[model samples]
Target chain A: MNTSKTQKHRADLLVSCVHDRAPDLIPALEAEVKRRGLEGEVKVVEAGCRGFCSMGPVLLIQPDGTFYVNVQPADVPEMVEETLVKGRVVERMTYQEPSSHACALYEDISFYSKQHRIVLRNCGMLNPASVEEYIAVGGYEAVGKALFDMTPEGVIEEVKKAGLRGRGGAGFAAARKWETGRKAEGDIKYVLANGDEGDPNCFMDRALMEADPHSILEGMIIGAYAMDAHQGYIYIPYEHTLSVKTMRNAIESARAYGLIGEDILGSGFDFEVEVRVGAHSFVGGESTALMHAIEGTVSEPRPKHIHTTEVGLWGKPTCLNNVKTWNLVPEIIGKGAEWFASIGTEKSTGTQVFSLAGKINNVGLAEVPMGTTIRELIFDVGGGIPNGREFKAIQIGGPSGGAVPASLLDMPMDYETLEEAGSMMGTGGVVVLDDRSCVIDVARYFLDFLKDQSCGKCSSCREGIRYMLEMLTNITEGKGKMSDLEVLERMGKSVKISSMCGLGKSVPNPVLSTLRHFRDEYVAHIEDHKCPAGVCKALIEHYINDQCNGCGLCLRKCPQDAITGEKKELHTIDAEKCIQCGVCFDVCRFDAVGVR
Target chain B: MPKLKSLDELKKLREQLQGDIKARTDSSTTITVGMGTCGIAAGARETMHAILAELESRGMDTHVTTVGCIGMCSKEPLVDIQQGDEPRVTYGNVNTEMVPRMIEEHLVQGNMVDEWVVGRVEG
Candidate 1:
């Protein structure tokens, strides 16, 4: 029996979600741990996002798996005195299910139990700032295997066998791009990790980047070896300060450990990676546009008639993968292609991490198998819609991605299925809409966001989005002509074909897809001159109902000061003073604010 | 944090680092203390200090943690010791003087102080 053990610390307190809204908790935990002279027995580690954003700032005691939710500095001493000193569980601090009213262990939580974790495996498990913590959990082992045990051709062949596709919206075959870059004629080739996550509702890449930057680094290292590229760049948006900082720290740690730089792990393969801050615009997600940005130009998409795999960045052959794509590399190499292929669907293998938001309970990052149904993700994983509201539609992908109504809740999600439903699996940013959501207004909202971020390089995209926004606005404000609908469809087709890049091409997806599935919402807004969901401020009117019961709550909370009420009398809204901000509708505890 | 030279060395380093993050890889027997307001008021804090001091003096590393109130306010300063796969035993009204004997008999000697035991929680 080889019993060489060095279990020095009795309890390792791994704090999840420090980068989120939670305040500084470790310092207080550390100070209390020391006061008891149990420093040798207790250790506090600031881990990365656990993907459980709803119960953020949670503290997990490893070995025991005692997870404490909503941990504050004030709770540290009692926790230390109880759990750290005496090894008793604090029931009040543990995670309690919203509906079940039952406490659960970290792994027992349905949000985590129902899903499979790959990219997030190392996220909340280690100190991302430390290379040793990464290694302790089998971090760089794949890089070592690729560097010494596998040949360049072998690496690419394994990836090809795995059937991994680019996760950055395109679903382009990842290994084929590596093959192109490998065979491309150039002495100076490059591999780029696209960290410019521009999707508004998505933070999957940021979570991985800030939490497990080493995973991306290791993946890029394997890619560089496969492509025989000497240098690479991780292009992050400047706004994700934590991602930039953690990635830089990971690279530095990798360098100091000799896992990066010349002759890594005693192998002759040489590679280095540097972070290139890029424009955070949606257009920058395009490979060519990102290449241009890396070359110190404006992030504008150019025609991809000539593939960037042949010639990119400074006229050199370049291989670019999303930060998520890079993140999956080391796993495929270490765990074998067959293991990865065994998961998800046959074609779209492996898991995808989705950032859940918008009118949904338990909004956070979830990594589910490729073919998970929309129902499972919403009800089982996301804890269904908030306030017991009926889920109206579950929007997959992002702004450029289309909306899938509740009628197709059981549709299994994959690249082919989502695209067939008129939505591309664009970066897995899921936004669930309740019955209160108007699909027309939803389309208008996305088009509005895209309109702001559109590079304006292509007239079809620029003018198409402008025209769509105008028509959408007209329909919402009860000014739409029936002919406007036909023109919208015709113009949408023209825009789809004439657009130069994805940003332009997918600009019409929102309008076209919503029209395909939910035409009645648009008809109601146009034919009946009624905002069915009471969303369009121009069409809807608000008034206090008889159920108000003299509640002064809305009066005090109303931003516009349009509500008037005595101490014990029903409130009345000054219609002229009401700006239709909907604050009254949201704040009314008695559901007294009526909208039409 | 020495620069690793080869894959074999990296493997060796992993085994060593695995020990560093032991709580991450494996679960072990644990010791629990109730630090509820009632427990603390009944001298649970001093009891914890004694437990830690006794273990520290003996150069022992144990998995000691805390819990909230267990609804036994009269039986405050409750301390429970659990070995692997064994039913957890709770001692009631524990004082600082009882810590050394508890650690010696329950933890080191693999025997419970049955006379002072108030409850048994079977896994």
Candidate 2:
């Protein structure tokens, strides 16, 4: 009601309207703007996630590029009165350096300053619902060039020259797959974008899809032109409700704008895209299983005697690429192969978007060029391990990927380098672990995940994973003999060699990599029946230390009520009644609880 | 919302849209007011309006905009001004009356208000 004369102008306030905490903050911002009678001069526009989840409820002031974090509804009035009406920055809301107490701009923050944004270039910068915003940032230009100026062979050639590999895990050459589909003997060819991101702690693909859906769509359209495919499908997991909605909207808008559907851009290249949502199945991310799911069949992978590029979806030549892989097509087509090749390593060209999560200070998506060392990714970009804990290991890739020890922190993170270090670059999920994490328990956790996700098609995968899980369970339970380690090694190798699909083949990665690196932890568990990190419940016990001031906080928080003491006296845990839940260890604020 | 017919049309559209973006995002001189909660509480909105009114009165082409807090909440109502390739000068606790002097000295005469300047961002 208090509309000012200047309120009709384009966005004056750009609130980060992400799914996390923006919903509650938006109304407060609007109400304050209205109450202050500055509505006419200040227009609020809701944008996507700004990648700084730890400091969410973030706001970015335009024109001057001032960034605010940890904003609350209560601070709205003064923000409007001081900043909006008086043209003054409310210093209390600005991001300050933790140690120096100096203010930092968004570009100057180390969390955003050190990273290169290729796949995530558009994230936090544009409104995903608006197609014009996508186009203004050069979204569909690559598809136009591919359709009008370049031939199909030229497009494929450009991709090959860029040295772009599949980002889905295997690092297969994307252009080679496109060439296969182009040359495959089939009248009806298909191109698929695999959005079924199954890796735990990885949300890079989901972020790209939800934030910049058009980029993926544009990439797929170009791929369709290169592979001579008439139809394309974007297979996203159903749990990704925002991604599905944004992608479906993006496809519709593109169709309505003549970027897709029949006679795209009047270039006579008729290609259409459909959004398919499937239930989350870990094994369903496999190419063959994905294609089978698209065909309305059971989501299970078959033997790959023939490559999917030659024999795929509905028994036709289907060119399937990961969401991130397809997203790169537009950039390569727009900037040329040489420009893309100049960014990363010689073999692995371009930047990799990593979901940096677990035990790190900054937990979000980071895009860095290939050949970036694990030390830089973890310490520099990820803000190092949280709470001053010593870095122990990083579980690179996902459940199927291997763990890299602290000694290998300097190793460059590329497909071949990670593989040579006994780990595969599985979808770029970098889960850092600290000294408190038990390596044996980490291996057992991943093995348990794989055992559940395996398709159970082959005996090597089904039986081998079962046996491995049993041994790991025994080791964690402090019931394992020394000879079981040999059995684990033999069965792990057999699974890797005899499994029918990638899921089965890579299931032993966590076990084998942990064995190869942290065998001492396993020996400690087997021989001395001791969990070094105090993680295994059966091998460890909790006790109150001398530091306890008898705060009674731990006693109240204990679910089993095993701890008892006076109000101001050190508490003792009844070892028989204690379930070793570690609640006391976690709740004790005085560093009094000890586990050994 | 007609479909772009050809490559030339697409390029032309991009140029037009880019012109609009550049008008707002790029300029020879940029004046930014921090409008985050801290900035607003400290009277940054008033400072921004003053700058906007001054620019409007002078009919200056200099781009004026608002950014979120830059983590100096202790010094509320921060203003940053940049001319050409020169370093951006950050002014702390800026008030409404400082707008005209900033525009006249920094924008017109190319002389920075050094006493008010708190920090400098390297170009």
Candidate 3:
């Protein structure tokens, strides 16, 4: 189809009123539209995500592509009146730098400038529900190609040639798994899309599934063809109602178009997919556990001897890949393997999608080439650490993944570099921590999560992680002995070697890597009983500066009523009652509250 | 919708589809909302409805479309306007109130509203 005619029109305006968690703005904006009585003049439509989230609630006016930042309900009035009413740009509210004196567009922003998106190509572009829209943008063409043009073996060969690796954390070769399942001796080979994304603070898969369900469906259909599998399953958490509905709609749409179910595109292949809702068990994220859950068994994982590709899901050759991984297959086939391989590093091919979250200025989803440096992601793309706070450390992967200290901040992001930096690119949960973060406290938090998540299948993972958690807890509480560090290390090593699955094996990552890099902080906790970041409440003390105006604000705000002072006098914090909720620090107007 | 048989016949059908898509014309404004799961969860559906209702009330020709997540979830209920030289303008965190003024300002006039513009990429 010629896209030029469609492109010839005036630039379409794209805006995100849904972001910033302000849903009421939609009605307010609509009411403002009616109130203004300019009903037919400007076309205001809701588009999917615009991929630039840090500056939300963000506004993008098209043709000019002017990006507005920090938009609110109040700002909407002036924005509609001055710019929309008068046809003049809102100069002050637009994203402008104090030093450059130049307004920056979305592409001009450091956050979105450095990324390339192929798998996510249709995310912000097309109407997900419209088959025609998807078709217009060359969606399902790969499925068409696979069904009409390529053989099962040919499709698998093309995927292998693409060098596509799983984005679902295991970086396993996508083609190799397909080949294994294809060759496996079973009439009931299953292709399962594990959308049961349980990694804390990671929502990339759920976002993709919800945003572009068809892409995942297309990929799964193509995978089924390649693997010669007739049945497929999409496993997502029951809480993901949006994803479930979207996936169901996409499946229905595919079925309606004859893209799925029996004799697809006259290829004489019969395949269909079922969307399975998983219970919210952290262990259900595990492959074995997921398979068990699908089988209506307990959501706990069992010891894995045989690979699932050979024997899985009722003793069938079952292939389980993450949502993001399967979403890329059709693209690889359509664009060719060489095109896919050319984008990312040689070893870890294809772009990886990440949820660039936490304490960072650009908290959005990012898809950079596999080898994009962490410096680029954190500083260039993420707009560096927020609040002028110094960059301390970044936690990659989830709780099971380790944190990369400042020393390795420059390391390129891929499977290997993260592994070398004592972190794993597990499911692409990149959390940037600023200077205010206490390393010990962060370690303790991760350990707490791991302790809760660990499936008790292995004694080393269950009891050993419990022990490490206790030690880390002791250190964070300022009651740890100097020898506790060595004991924690010894225990962490044993857990790493003796654990069952990835969750168990890598549970020691936070404790071990923190001890490896930030041992001095641990020593400070043990020897001096000091939290350098002033985050550890047990070791830190709260005080009121002499600058306090004796305003009762802190005293009132303090849940414990820790502060006591007379008018115009310095305030004091009663240590016994102070709960360290940091409310006083937040409420104090005179900078009187001090944490040390 | 007959189940297509034979890969070659499917190929021919695909070619026919190519022609059909190219020859189509609506001239109606296509409002593609970034209602990806994140957007809807963020409330793009209501934003979409507000725009659709605005166009419908005025009896103006408009086609409201929904797309997947654009990765920038922080700014959602994202709206993309495609009407006539100008690229698509994306408004983040949109609602019913901004619709009338947006229609008056940008839809009728050829001018772009900078305040409602979230992030515009030339590429």
For all candidates, what are the clash counts? 15, 46, 80
Whole-model lDDT, candidate 2? 0.84
Model 2 lDDT tens row, A247-316: 9999988887789888887899999889898878889999999998898888999988898888999999
lDDT of all the models against the reference?
0.86, 0.84, 0.75
Candidate closer to the true structure by TM-score (higher is better), 2 or 3: 2
- lDDT tens string, model 1, A285-404? 888889989999988878888888898988899999998899999999999999999999999999988899998888899999999999999889888888878888867789889899
Residue B14 lDDT, candidate 1, scale 0-100: 76
Instruction: Kindly list the per-residue Cα lDDT of model 2 for residues B1-123, writing each as its tens digit.
Output: 788777777666654454223322445777777777788899987787788777756656566666766899988799988878899999888999888897898878988888988899888
lDDT of 2 at B108: 84
Q: What DockQ score does model 3 reach against the true complex?
A: 0.07
Candidate 3, which segments miss by more than 4 Å at Cα? A1-4, A7-20, A24-44, A51-59, A68-87, A91-104, A546-556, A566-569, A588-592, B1-123
Model 1 per-residue lDDT at A419: 94
- TM-score for chain B of all predictions: 0.78, 0.77, 0.71
DockQ of the two-chain complex in candidate 1:
0.30
Give the number of the best model, judged by DockQ: 1
- Candidate DockQ values, in order, are 0.30, 0.21, 0.07
Docking class of 3: incorrect
